[model samples]
Target: MPDDSAPRPSEEAVEEAILTVASLPGAAKTVTPEDVARSVAAGPDWQSLLPSVRRGALRLAQAGRLVLYRKGKPVDPSDLRGVYRLGLPPEG
Candidate 1:
């Protein structure tokens, strides 16, 4: 069973998310906590996540695994807001 109380994400998970997102096209950019949350929530053994998970998730996105775009420039998760989506692999 997975521990639900743990808030911090292991570097491996961050790297995995980054690699998964990186497989898509475009320059790397910011990803939202909600996005990460949703991803984490999908695991069968996973329960709820803490707010701190956002930090690791953002790190993964900003680290170049995912392409982030905003205001005509690449931005960090902290600079993102409103509705956003990942643009890679041409999701239709």
Candidate 2:
């Protein structure tokens, strides 16, 4: 269980959570930003982690560790908006 009173996760932690959740859906399967955010969220305020989760996902996508999608098609991480999902690279 996470410490409800603890501060929001750091960039590194968010990154790790993104990868961890992405990996769980198996290769080429997707995980939503909310998935990553919930994994590291301190409590019921997981929604507050959205910005950090997006940033972490973008960083991972840039590093070729993950892919970003919108409407079932791949999109540039920097250009992502609204709802999106993350997945491991095809060969992952």
Candidate 3:
């Protein structure tokens, strides 16, 4: 469990961090949910933010702003399960 001092970013903030990290110039790989959580967390307690990060990523994927993958394949946003990575949709 995270101590009261653990970071608790807002939903929007978590989503933004996901996008920011995924869109970094030259980024050539998908980002794990833990990456997003770490980006917004202030310390080791970042693990505590995993739930919020996952929730934000799911919402973003459902909205078509992000893609969620499992086993190297994109999973239905409505039926995600197990470990996943976040990436942006291909640009035209």
**Highest lDDT model number:** 3
Candidate 2 weakest ten by summed lDDT: 22-31
Model 3 lDDT tens row, 7-68: 47899999999999999988767989888888898767888889998899889998999999
lDDT for each residue of candidate 1 in 1-82, tens digit (9 for 90 to 100): 6656656556567446544544535534544434555555556433244344445445655665454555545556777664
lDDT of 2 by residue, 1-92 (tens): 54567776789999998988888745347878887888887577888889999988899899988899999989998798898998888882
Candidate no. 1 TM-score: 0.37
lDDT per model, in order? 0.50, 0.84, 0.88
What's the number of clashes in each of the models? 5, 0, 0
Number of clashing residue pairs, candidate 1: 5
User: Candidates' TM-scores?
Assistant: 0.37, 0.84, 0.90
> Which is the winner by lDDT between candidate 1 and candidate 2?
2
Give every collision pair in model 1. Answer: 28-67, 28-68, 29-66, 29-67, 29-68
RMSD of each: 6.7, 3.1, 1.7
Query: lDDT for model 2, on a 0 to 1 scale?
Result: 0.84
In model 1, which runs have C-alpha deviations exceeding 4 angstroms?
Answer: 1-11, 21-47, 50-53, 69-76, 87-92
**Residue 80 in model 3: lDDT:** 91
The Cα RMSD of model 2 versus the native structure comes to 3.1
How would the candidate models be sorted by lDDT, starting from the highest?
Answer: 3, 2, 1
